[model samples]
Every structure is written in structure tokens, then in C-alpha cells.
Target: MKLRQVVPWGFTAIVAVLIGNGVLSQLTARGLTNTVNEVMQGYRVQTSLQALEQVIVDLQLGERGFIITRDPDFLRPYQTAQSNLAQEFARAKTLLQNEPAQLQNLNELEALSNEAIAVLSNNIARVRNGETPSSEELIQGNQVIEQVRVKVAQMLQAESQTLATRKDIVTRAEILSAISTLGGTLLGTLLGLSIVGFVIRQVVQPINQVTLAITSSSTEIAATVAQQEHFATEQATSVHQTNSIMEELGASSRQSAEQAQKTATGAQEVSQLAETGIQAVSYTLEDMSVLKAKVEQIAQQILHLSQQTDRIGNISELVTALANQTNMLALNAAVEAVRAGDSGRGFAIIAEEIRKLADQSKNSAAKIGVLVSDIQKAIAATAIATQEGTQTVENSLKTAEGMAQTFTGVTTAISSVALNNQQISLNAQQQAIAIQQVVSAMNSLNEGAAQTANGISQTKISTQKLNEAALDLQAVV
Candidate 1:
């Protein structure tokens, strides 16, 4: 608005940028410091674990030498390792005290180390007592020692992973710090240069313009009054154009409001439709789940029917066997009757009929068995098909669930759209009111221009007294 405000505001912008950069740098530096500390701590703990592993190896070597050679002199390294191992473990634990997970691992490592050392002690004591250590005990010690080494390796790997993560964080922090510093420098430099350029354009260049305008204003008062009247008339014309445009804008704003309301209503309808679709999908999913259960039941029933068919077929086979036996007995009876002559003739006929009936019964049982076998096959196929139908229903249930979720999302989006449209309608209505106010302001401005023209006529009369003063000011310039 004025050249006087540029200096403070421009310098303030530069200062704000510097302050923001400093704050960001401070934050990055703090984070970097913390990560560096963690990295350093990790290295320390890793060193301690390596040293502890070495001590364990030395102890194992010393124990083996003493066991084989029976030389107590070999016990010297073992003793030294025993003392150093405890210190190393304590140091590692101290360094990792802040990390609960690492501390837990270290505790386990310490426990295994102690157990291995205890077995080693027992072996050495056996040699001193003039007794040979058992092969089992020796093997147990070696295995436990190996476990210690493995635990140490795992701890080292964990530390390494943590260190790698910290290193990445360090890299990112350094990059951000550099970017903030460089960007702040560039921004400050550009702002300073712009401020200088603004001074030249807004302040320095305008000084000459002001001097020229002062020199040009030595015109006669009559022409200045006429110019004022012409400006007033043009301002009135411009106000008339502005008022017409504002009226058009107001009408457009009202139309926009109506359109926004219609859009909001459509969005609301869409939201309702989405909700209805979601409910339909939910019902379909429920029905599909019920259908899946029903199909499963049907499959089970088909399986049961197949089992019953097998039982029925067995019964049919038993019946067929009994019928064959009965037929054989009847044949024997008919032969006996024929030996009795005329008195046994009726018995022979009756036996002959009994044989025929037995044969018929056997044939009927055979047909029933065949029918049962076919029914079993049909039941088996039905069972398989029912399983497939169950699977299909399950899949359809999953799909329906997905569609229901999709409909839920659509409903949420439509609700948002409806809300946005309502907001747009409200804003349009507000803009229409603002436009009406602006039109009224334009009318007032037209009246202000007329008043300004009248004031200028009075100013023209007053300038007659200032003619001598203008001459004096011209000499001073």
C-alpha cells in the first residue's frame, strides 16, 4: 500500500525465514545427536559381546587342555576368563540397560555362559580329584558353549540391525538439515534483492515522477477545473457500467444458488440409493450364508442316505442267500415225495411250487440289490454336487460382503458430496447478497463523483490565491 511499510515487512520476512531454519536445524541436530548416541552405544555393546565370546572360547580351550593333559598350569587361562567374562557381561548389560529387549537377550546370554562354565568347572574338578570326566559331561559342556557363541552372534546381529536403522535416520536428518540451511539462505538472499528492487521501483523511480507532476501542475486553474468535470462525467459512466455488471453478477449468483441446491438434492438422492444398495447387498450376503448352511446340511443328508443304501444292499444280499437255501431244500423234498408213489404225488407238486416260489423270491432280492447299488451311486453324485453348491454359496457370500463394503464407501462419498453441495449453495447465496451490496455501493460512488465535481469547481476558485504560492514552490524545487 505504501513504500514506508516495505522495509519492516521485508526484513521481517527474512528474519522469519532465518528463525524457521534455525528451529528446524536445532530439531534435526537434536535428533541426530540422539541417533549418534544410540549408534555409539550399540558399538560399545557389540564390542563387549565380542570380547565376551572370546573369553568363552579361551575358557573352553583351557578346560580341554586341563582335561587331556591333567596339567593344572592350563587352569590359569580358565581362571582369567572366568573373571573377565563376568565383567564383560556386566558392561554389555549396562550399556543396554535402556533397551529392554537387548537387556533380555544379554541376560539369556549370561545365563547360558554361566551354565557352560559350571560344567567346565565340574570337568576340571574331576581331573583334580584323580577321576576322569564322563564323555557325556564333556559333550554337554561343548554343546552349551556352542549355544553361548550362537547367542552372542544373535545379539551382535540385533545390534547391527539397530545401528543400520539409526544410520539411515542420521542420513535423512543430515539431508534435511542441509536442505533447510540452503533453502533459507536462498530465500533470504532473494528477499533482500527483491526489497532493494522494490525500493528502486516504488520509492526511487516515483521521486522523479512526483517532481514532474509538481512541475506539470503549474497549469492555469480553469483547465484543471474542466479536467475535474470531465473525470466526474466519465466516473458516472463507469459507475453505470459497473452497476449493470453487478446486476448481471447478482442474477448469476442467484442462478448458481439454485443450481447448487439442485445438485445437493441429487447428491442426497444418490446417497440414499447407495444406502439402499448396501442394505440389499447385506441381505444377499445373509441369504447366501443361510444357503451355504442349507447346502452343507443337504450334503450331509446325501452322505447319510448313501450309508443307508449300503445297509439296505447288505440286507438284500442276505435275503437272496436265504432264498437260495430254501430252494435247495424244496428240491430235496420233491425227490423224496416222488419215491412215495401216488400218495406222495401231491407232496411232489407242492415241493415243485415251493421251489419255483423260492427262485422267484431270490430273483426279486437280486433286483432289489441292484436297485440299491444304483441308488447309492446317485446319492454319492448328489453329495459331491451338494459340496460344490456349498462352496459356490460360500464364495458368493464373500462377494456379497465385498459389494456391501463398496456400497458403504459409496454412501460415505455421496454424503460428502451432498454436504459440499449444500455448502456451495450457501456460499452462492452469500455472494448474491454481496453483489447486491456492491451494486448499491456503485450507485453511491456515482453520487460521490458528482459531489467531487462540485468540490473541484470550488477548488478552482481557491487556487487563484495559491498562484503566488505555486511560483514560490517552483523556485524552491
Candidate 2:
């Protein structure tokens, strides 16, 4: 059970006990009051019985006085007693009504009283008639009066006994009331004290212990929070520094990206130049091939002209031999004419003319031979010159072909260099983009660290307040 519930029950139990004590005392006091009233009633019954007996005595004494002296004043006493006697008897019966046995005794006493009253009245009437009553009548009256006294005495005694019993009961009731009141008060006091002690054990002591535990726990939390706050402050400072470094890194990455873009543009221009060189070298090689073919055709024509010069030399030698034969035939014909004398004069003249013609023909043939020999020598020199010229042309053509091949290789190398430069530029651009992304990530981390630090600081403040509250509760408990 909780403290509030247990404490209330304990106090409620103590109140209940006290209320019960008060109720018992009230009951005992009521009993004592009723016993006292009954004791007073008994005294009233005894007094009434005695008064009835006195009335009878007065009647008898008045009768005796009147009988002895005949006095009118004596009749007065008798008349007063006679009048009071019935009233006194009625009072006695009324007082004794609660006691059945006493009521029966009173009825008997009433009959005897009537008899005595009758005897006393007879004596008085005799005295009034101027004649005296007899001694027997007087004696009889005295006896009856004595009987009344005895009846009164008996009733009185009975009343006295009843009063004594009532007194004893009253005394006992009073003593009992005193004892019960004292015992109840003592018991209620003890129970109330016990309830108070129980409440302290079940509620107050445990509350004190809980308060102490809370105070200690809150204090420890406050210390831990303070340490965390210090760490958060350091974290905030580091984040700020990291953010500065990231800003610088981002700038460097941007610069690298721009440099890569420029390199790519330059590579494109170099590739265009290499393409132009390739076209130029190919065109030069084609023109050299055509020139080489023309030089070879010219050398073949020179060799054909040398062969024609040798045939011309052979024809000149044959013509020179024919001329020599014609000259010898002309000289033999001239000698035969001289041997015939005067009959052959005209024939001799003709033979001499033929000899002159033959001589001239032989001289022309020798000159032709000399010209042919010079022409043949000139042809030989021309053939040698043509061969040398053809060789020079072939060598020049080979060198030109070599130069074309070298130029082709150089163009291929330059094109490869341009392609490589383009690849390098693309790689540099990609690296710059990656660096930029890293810088952005670092900035985000720095911001998150700052937020965490702020949260830790707030936690420290809350812990301190909680510790203070725990201390206050501990003190109160």
C-alpha cells in the first residue's frame, strides 16, 4: 500500500477506538442515574407508611382525651386525624404500587385501619351523648390502634430494606462507571499512540529513503551532463575549423576543373594540325612518283638514239669501199686507149674523164667515213650521260619515298599524342568533380556536429535543474 492510504487508515482506527470509549462511558453514566432515581422512590414509600401510622395514633389519642374529660378541643384532634387517615392510606398504596408484595400488605393495612377508625368513632359518639364509653370499648380501641402501629412498622421496615438494596446498587453502578471510563480512556490512548507509531514506520521513513535516493541519482546525472557539455563545446570548435578547411578545398577543386577544360581545348587544336600534316605528306609522295616515271621514259629514248648512230656508221663504211672500186676501174680503161693510137683518140678522151670522176667519188667517201666515226663517238658519250642521269633520278625517287614514309609515321605519332592529351583532360575534370563532392559532404558533417553540440548543452541545463529539485524533496522528506 501507498503512504497516503496506510496513514489514513491508521488514524481512522485510532479515532474509532476513542469514539467507542466515549459511547461506553455514556452508557455507564445512564445506568448510575437510573439506580439513584429508584433509591429515591424507596424513601418516598417508607415516608408514606410512617405518615399513615401517625394518623392512626393521633386519632386514638384524641379519642382518649375526649373520653376522660369530655373536652370539645379534644374532638378537634380526633376530627383532624379522621380526615387525614384515608388520604394517608391512599398515599401509602400509591407509593408502594411498583412492589407487588408491598401493595398486598398495604391493602391489609387499609382494612385494619378502617376497623380502628370505626372503634374510635364509637367512643367519640358516646362522649358527645353525655354518657361515657365502657372500659372494654376503650381497651378495644387501644388494641386496634396498636395493630395499626405494627402494620405501619412492618411496611416501614419493608420500605427501608428496599431502599438499602437500591443504595447498594447505586454504589456499585457508580464504581463500575468510574472503572470503565478509566479503562477505556487508557486503552484508547495506548491504541492511538500505537497507530501514530505505525504510520511513521510504514510511510514517513520510506519517504525519507526515497528522497535521498533521488537526490543522489540526480546529482550523478548532473555531473555526467556537465562532462558531456564540455565535449560538445570542443566538438563545435572542431566543426568550425573543419568547415574553413573544406571551403579552401572547394576553391582548389574549382581551379583544377578550369585547368582541365583548357587542356582539352588545346588537344583538339593539335589533333587538327596533325591531320593537315598527313594530307600534305601524302600529296608530296604522289607528285614524286609521277616525276620518276617521266625520267625513266627519257632514259629509254636516249638508248634508242644511240643504236641508230651505230647503223649509220656501218652504212658509211660500205659506201667508202664502193667508191674505191669505181676509181680503180676508171684508171684501167685509160691505159687501154693509149695502146690503140690514132684510131681510138675520141675513146681515150672519154676514159680520161671517167678517171677524174672516180677520183672525186673516192675523196667524198673518205670524208663521209671520218664524219661517221665522229658521230659514233658522240653517240657513245650521250649514252653514258643518259645512264648516269637515269641512276640519279632513281636514287632521288627512293629518298623521296623514304621521306614520305617518315612523314606518315610522324603524323600517326602526333595524332596519338593528341588523343592521349584529350583523355588526360577528361580524367582531370572527373577528379575535380569528385573533390567538390567531398567538400560538400564535409560541410554537411560540420553542420550536424554543431547541432549535436547544442543539444548536449540543453541536456546539461536540464540535469542541473533536476538535481536541485531532488535535493529540495530530500530535505522536505
Candidate 3:
């Protein structure tokens, strides 16, 4: 049959056999094997110790050869021995980590090696110069070598006994460790097989069913989300329409407010015009008053001129009376001359000349009266012109006053209009403020709507993620 089909039974038997040979029942056999292995390792250690001892002997021989024959060929063996000695010492140290006494022996060996180096150097120098070696020095060096060899041999025998004893014990321990490891392996294998069977039968089938259900639910959710997208589009269209209507309303309100403001400004200009007209009328009335005062002064001058004309007329009448009296006296003198005859003729002639002089004076007085009468008539005419002028000025003043009154009425009407316009302006300003408040509220609403939309979008994304997480957990379960 197939090896996979045979593996479980075959492995079981192998595990059973290993457990039978293990430490649970074979302590004595394990101890013996351990003792044998320790003996073999100790034999290796002893061989290394012997090699170090031989290096010392070679070094001594090299000294003796230099001292006796003075040959460089003999020193070659000494150098080789020195190198071999270092190698052997390192090998022994690594192998004898638990042997404290052997390490002490190694320290003593190092001292001997150093002594051999000194002795060889001296002997070589002396022999090369053709000097013969002393027998006593050669004998002493040989004795040191022999002693070192004996000590190495002793250390080797002792380590060999210890290694043999430990080897037997190690052999038995190895058998027991093999048996225990085999028993653990068999138990672990059975448990692992049982776990695999349980996972396949109990966990995998249910998880597959749950995954199928979750996939069906996710498909339905996708259909619902497509419907929600259509709804969202309609909602966005509605919001846009609402925003457009609000913009129209805001524009109309702003236009109305501007028109009202223009009307108020026009009313204010009218009021200012009325006030200016009243001021002009007032100035005209003041000028008319000045003209009336000047006319009154002219009338006074005419009255004074009439009084002077009347005085001149009276003086002319007095001159006429004086001329009449002079003529009568002259006639009386002529009558007396007729009665006196030839003796009164010269006096009569002088009286006749006086009568002519009186007549001329009378004529001059009459002319003066005419001149005074003309002056009086002219004064009366001037006075009449002044009266007419005064009446005209009075009429002008009255007209100016009436015009002023009309201007005042216009001013009053303008003031009423200005007050009404101020009220209208205040109402318009209040309406504009109300509209501004509405605009501000609309802006706040727009901002809030944007924030709300963003929050809703984020929430939708988070919900999708949460659904995914639930599906993942459902899969895991």
C-alpha cells in the first residue's frame, strides 16, 4: 500500500519500542553508556597531555644538541616542538574545562617551557662560538624534562580512570533520554491529529455557511444603496430650487428698499428748495421796506418846497402893494402941479417918471408871482410823484410779504413732506434691516445645511465601514 497509509501504525510501534528502552525502565544501562563516553573523551585529553610533555622533551633535546654538536638542524626540532606544544596545550584546555587539577598542571608546564627557551638560547650561542657545553647544565635540563614527563603521565592515568567511570554513566543516560523523547513524540502526534479532525468537522463547515449568508445580505444592501443614491439626487435638486427662490426674494426686497431711499432723498431736496424760496422772499421784503423809507423822505422834501413857494408868493404881493402906493403919490403930485400952473410943471414931469418906475416894479412883482406859482405847481407834482412812489413801494412790500407767506406755506408743506419722508426712510431702513436679518439667517441655514450634508456623508461612509467590519467578524466567527 501507500507509505502515507502505513505511516501512523508504523510510527506508533516505533514510539512504543523507544519508550520500552528509555530512562523510565533503563537507568542502569544509561549510566553505563555515559561512563563509556566519558572514558573516550578522557583518553583524548590524556593524549594531548602526553603531546605537551613530549614538546618539553624536544626542547631539552634541542638544548643538548646545541650544547654538544652546535647544529642549527637540531634547533629546528625545538621550534617545531614549541609550536606543537602550544597546539596541544590549547586542545587540552578546551577538553578539560571541568578538570581544575589538570589546568594547574598546564601552568607548571608553561613555566618549564619558558625555562627551556632560556636554556636553549644560551646553549646555542655558546656552541656556535665553538664552546663546549658543561655536563652539569645538560644533566640538570634532562632531569627537568624527565620530571615533567612523569607528572604528565600521572595526570593522564588519573584522567583516564575518571573518564571511564563517567562514560559508563553517560551511556545509560543517553538510552533513557531517547526513550523519553520518543514517548513525548507519540503523545504530541495523537493530540495534533485529534485537533485537526475537530477543526475540520466542527469549525470550518459552520463558518462557510455564515459566509454564504453574509454575501447574500451584502447584495441586498447594495440594491438599497442604489435606491438611496437616486433619492439623494432628488433632494439635491429640491435644495437648489429652494436656494434660487430665496435669491429672487432677496433681490426684490433689496430693490424695493433702494427705491424708497431714492424717494426720501427727493423729498429732502424739495424741502431744501422751499426753504431757499422763503429766504429769497424775506430778502425782497427787506429791500421793499428800504424803498418805502426812501419814498417817505422824498415826500417830506416836496412838502418843504411847497412851503417855500407860498412864502415867495406872499413877498410878491407885498411888492405889488408898494408899487401901487408909489403910483398914487405920483398922481397926487401931478394934481398939485396943475393947480400951481407954470411953477409945478417940472415937479409933474418927475412924478410922471416915478409913476412909470412904479408900473415896472408892479410888472416885475407879477412875473415873480407867476414864477412862484410855477415852482409851487412843480412841487405839488413832485409831491404827487413821491406819494405814488411810496404807494408803489408799500404795494411791493405787501406783495413781498404775501410772497413770503406763500413761501412759508411752501416751507410748511415741505417740512411735512420731509417728516413723512423721514418716516418712510425709517420704515425702509427697518425693512432693509429685516431683510438683512433674513439673509443672515439664510446664510446660517446654508452653512448648517452644508455641515449637515457633510456629516450625513461621513455617517454613511462610517456605516458602510461598520457593515464591512460586521461581515469580517462574521467570517472570522
- lDDT of candidate 2 over 348-420, digit per residue (tens): 5545545554564555445445544644454344344434434443543454355445435534533443353
The lDDT for every candidate, in the order shown, is: 0.63, 0.55, 0.55
- Residue pairs in collision within model 1: none
Best lDDT goes to which candidate?
1
**TM-score for all predictions?**
0.46, 0.50, 0.37
lDDT of 3 at 153: 73
lDDT (10s digit) by residue, model 3, range 286-329: 65566456546656755765676687689779989999999999
**118, model 3: CA deviation in Å?**
99
Regions of candidate 2 where Cα sits further than 4 Å from its true position: 1-6, 237-477
Off by over 4 Å in 3: 1-255, 428-477
The regions of model 1 sitting more than 4 angstroms off are: 212-477
How accurate locally is residue 468 in candidate 1, as Cα lDDT from 0 to 100?
32
The alpha-carbon lDDT assigned to residue 217 of candidate 1 equals 34
- The lDDT-based order of candidates, best leading, equals 1, 2, 3
C-alpha RMSD values across all candidates:
35.4, 91.9, 77.7
Winner on TM-score (1 vs 2):
2
